[model samples]
Target: MTHKRKIFAGMSAIAAASLVLTGCGGGGGGDVDADGNVVIELAQWWEPELPDGALRGLMDQFEEQNPGIKVELLSGPYASTREQLVTGAASGTMPDVVGLDGAWVNDFAKQGAIADLSALMTEHDYDDSQLASQVEVDGSTYMVPAVNFVYPLYTNDALLADAGVDAPPSNRTEFADAARAITEAGDAAGTAMPLSLETPSGVQNQVMSWLWASGGSMLKDGKPDLTNDGVTETIEYFDDLYQDGVFAPGAFTMKEQDMVEEFTNGRVGMMVDSLAHLTMIRESNPDLKFSISALPAEDGYDGKRGIPYASWGLGVSESSDHKEEAWKLFEFLMSEDANAELASMAKAFPGNVASVPDFVEDDELMSQAFDIYQAGYPANEFTGLPVAE
Candidate 1:
């Protein structure tokens, strides 16, 4: 299961970066015990690692290295993570540290469920730019990204070659041509788009990306604006692609996961999904060569680099007496050694730039994912509702 990473010709290098503040709120949850040892509970939705494993190895190392702090994990699936944290926070029973979704950061900050991490980051000299999903609200930093995922366009190089598509497309017009070429060659569907209008997430994969890349947004001033000019233009472009037979017939009904399978099975030329799919594809379609890049945009439209920001991150409960201790554990887990463990175990990339592991740095495909994620985009967490526009 080897992947040969691709580099977009004539594309400049990608830059990565991330935020904000208020409240002496780090004093409520689990705290230090009578033995002068701090006991911090970290309840996260990230699998600690993949199935059949956990992040215990890294924690074990951390505990051995830092004798005074004891880190406890409250494990569960991501589906119920937010509910658990929300209920716990409301009851003042939340863990010392908790896992957060990108969309939850702002609300939690407003609720004062999480502590400000600026001071802690500064004190530890943590280079924050590495965080793919660092959560900031109204200019204050609330959380540091951990298990982050980015939805990038993955193309099957072999399919593209077989279709005689010599180069990747940088704009929609060019992309359509490439897609047409692939379809005409009969190697596979040019692309598999996720467009099940059944859910907001479906819309995101098939459309929101284009809006953001074209300088439009799903949320403006806290309200949903579905009729923005950029959105309309994107829709028109999508319509053109559809009419041209650039997308598979099932694309309009397929969920994101289904499209992922289409790409891996060689039934589709490209897939719009998480970089994690690479590992999955490696297992399911071992001989495939693929490359990933940000979704294509109009040639002059911000060069089509915009996309959404999403991740799982570490946050200290507002009332944790052991804020410093909690941060210590976080820093350790996000360190180079421990972060690498996360990649191998959880199929996650490092949230800290300094901790990028070899598996990423050594592989062009994986390395490119880090670059795409770091290249900031006009994003909306798209939580529940937008503020009044």
Candidate 2:
């Protein structure tokens, strides 16, 4: 299967040029090991998500190819990893190569926690044009998206069928009706929404997702446009669902992981979630049946849909003594073959524009997602926002 890349026009270019911080943190580089190999510690939430030892196997290949350099993975869950990175940034003890979220680029750059990739790219003669997109801060590249996970509507076939729905909803009215019907059919809710105030990204992933799917934007001229009609209608639509009792219980406190689990356990009929969870969902419920589609739009919307996406971004620590060696790892990861391998392993879209995943040819759900992606634009407004949690 061939994928024609779509321009990332829906993603708001982060241009926080004037933001500044006073401190600099560096001194977290790895040291020489017993065998005289240069050790570089990498911290991220990606390894656990991949197949057991898949990432390790990739590192093993990297170690073999690049002799005398060792990579140590410090992997954990998303929440803990974010907390750890935040703590590391403040304490000046960040790992050499870190998995970054687009939202963290601005804050980390302002604090001087992450290295300037533009300089390193120039020094190494890296051709960044092949990269999907670079996260920038103060006009300097800070992070590169390693792989992309798109949010699509996931519907349980049994639930929809039991609710008397013929197909997945494609517009707002149908979605609401489907949700209500599914909820009325049984104990399961029509949809599961994670709106936890603790993490607050649910607002971005769930609430804002509705707006984006309908070709709406939260920004105008790079500024907040909350007062716009689109945002107002989106909020009203959500409220209508809430008033109709179509949303799963404990929505206000429900986290993203909990929402995915609910869908996996047959407690929810539908959800707009990341493709990265496809593997997990299948592993947890081998017999479960589901389908993926673009998030429903407004009734009259004929324009390109806005698909929300998150990235497994990569960046190096500002203070690492092994910046050069760390970049070699970065280069290896971004290489076409390696990037494609990672994307396939995670069931995601590659971050390298030239790297296409052949795994989609055999996977029905992923093929649908790839089609949806090619048809629409990536809509992640929080990509470079400060304090974007």
Candidate 3:
């Protein structure tokens, strides 16, 4: 069966199961309490299991601050979360609050699954500038940025030194020279440039980063620009990298986990991956001297120092019966203290600007990550091709 067909089949099963449960519970009773407390359910895909009472603790604090409010957390797999959410919205069983990746927020807002928060922003004194740029779509915000994930270039400092390199390369020419030197010395298999053809999406994302760094954009004034010289140069650069034997053999078949292991195990000199790899790399190799840097740019391009930023955020459903209560919870979660707490619990980056102060003295990885965040550009998730309507 096709991918879309399988997704539809899985959603049908979920809807059937939800209906069975609803029938057993006597079907669609009131969602509020006797004391007029507005109960709101929050659907998220952060983990397969509910967030071990950490979110509940936050909810308890929210309830204490607002006496007539309650929040429930429901968790599921990320792959199925969006489908289930859309299904629920169609069936009028949508949760009051929902957690979504930023890319999905635009489509959801356009479809009216999420309520517009422009008015709420004014009433709550919320500023769009406080959140990351990626979460904002065409001037109106659909969701509040909750956590951010950044992709950085991971380099083994010791390997570079052994290969007679004193420091990491800040641009493409020096990077290629270093990679070739490492490969010749037999200390490493050069650089494992991420170009997995098996997963075209991954290849496309990497290409866009290079294109942007080369001072090119997928769109110019809302029109496609695939025929530009910068785009061609970006593609040719990767093709040359492959032809020069810099990339690992059979890289087209290499999955993300394989790439991570290759670099961590000292087989590869450098790899580009998420910030989450820092903890694992440090634990697995205490003696491993590595540094994280923003992805390199073309030699003379003005936009050369850019990295792709990915993240998730929180939103309220349009069909929600308890929007006011839901917004209260949302506001509480975005507060500096709560954001810091959530960042600690999730081992993820904070989404609020004020939380930066709290995180400055927390840990080295977070400190490095925050630096990258300040220097990086918004990630390009829509840099290639047009989606068929």
What pairs collide in candidate 2?
Answer: 26-319
Across residues 1-389, which tens digit of lDDT does each residue of candidate 3 receive?
Answer: 99999998887768745742442122111167677766677777764432577777877887898887776666667755666676665555667778877657767776677877776777778775665543444555677667766677788887888899887777778778888888887857777755566555455445677666554666665566787777777778878877888776667777766778888889998777777667787898888878877677788655435566555678877777677777777778788888777766666667776676345476775687678667655566452123401
Ordering by lDDT: 2, 3, 1
Between which residue pairs do clashes occur in model 3? none
- Per-prediction count of colliding residue pairs? 11, 1, 0
The lDDT per prediction is 0.68, 0.86, 0.68
- Find the candidate with the highest TM-score and give its number: 3
Which ranges in model 3 have alpha carbons more than 4 Å from their true place?
A: 2-30, 47-51, 122-125, 134-139, 212-216, 222-224, 301-305, 357-362, 383-389
> What are the per-residue Cα lDDT tens digits for candidate 1 across 1-389?
12323342112111000000011123355656689877777778675346654666567788899998877666667745665666555545567788776667776777777877876788778877665445566666787666556677788898889888776666777778888888999858898677776544767656777666555666566555667777778888878888888787776677878888888888898767876667788899889888887777776766436665455677877767777787888777667677766755655556665555566656788777777755654354453232211
TM-score of each: 0.78, 0.80, 0.85
- Give candidate 2 regions above 4 Å deviation: 1-28, 31-39, 64-69, 76-84, 91-93, 122-127, 183-188, 265-267, 283-287
Tens digits of per-residue lDDT for model 2, 1-389 = 22322233212111111110111123475778899999898889999888899999999999999999999887878865776677667767788899999988888898898999999999999999888777876678999989989999999999999999999999999999999999999999999889888878898889899899988999886668898999999999999999999999999999999999999999999998898789899999999999999999999999999888999999999878888899999999999999999998887888887787888899888988988987887778888777776
Residue 359 lDDT, candidate 1, scale 0-100: 64
TM-score-best of 2 and 3 = 3
